[model samples]
Target: MRRFNLKEFRSERNLTQKQLIAKTGIPNVTITQIENGHKSLSKELRKRIFDAFQVDERLYVA
Candidate 1:
């Protein structure tokens, strides 16, 4: 899968980290780490993010 473009996605949606947390139920630090590439997207986190964005995972994976 390609890297999750958290920063770009958030920017496009005008969503702050806190707002994303509220929307996705992901912890703030984890979101920060993911955005900074310090962490990888686990299956569960990807699912949560996809659900929040209402996106299909096939669009992310080859």
Candidate 2:
């Protein structure tokens, strides 16, 4: 199974966690937790991510 690497994607955009938080209005802790696998990606958050990155949601899930 292929897995999406959040770190890589984020890095490719040159967006720091703080920058992502600013762009998406998602809290830093929540973003950190989700990136670290400490929390699941909520539907809202996933949508925000898609909006922020213009990437398909399926890439995030798989």
Q: Pick the candidate with the highest lDDT.
A: 1
Query: What TM-score do all the candidates reach, one by one?
Result: 0.82, 0.74
Q: Which residue window of length 10 is worst by lDDT in model 1?
A: 1-10
lDDT tens digits, residue span 6-61, model 1 = 78879989999999999999999999998999998789988888898898887766
What is the RMSD of candidate 1? 2.0
What C-alpha lDDT do the candidate models reach, one value each?
0.85, 0.78
Go through the candidates in order and give the C-alpha RMSD of each one to the true structure: 2.0, 2.2
Prediction 2 global C-alpha lDDT: 0.78
- Per-residue lDDT of 1-62 in model 2, one digit per residue for the tens? 23666566679899898888888889888888888988887777778877887877775444
Please give the TM-score that candidate 2 achieves against the real structure: 0.74
Model 2 Cα shift for residue 41 (angstroms): 0.9
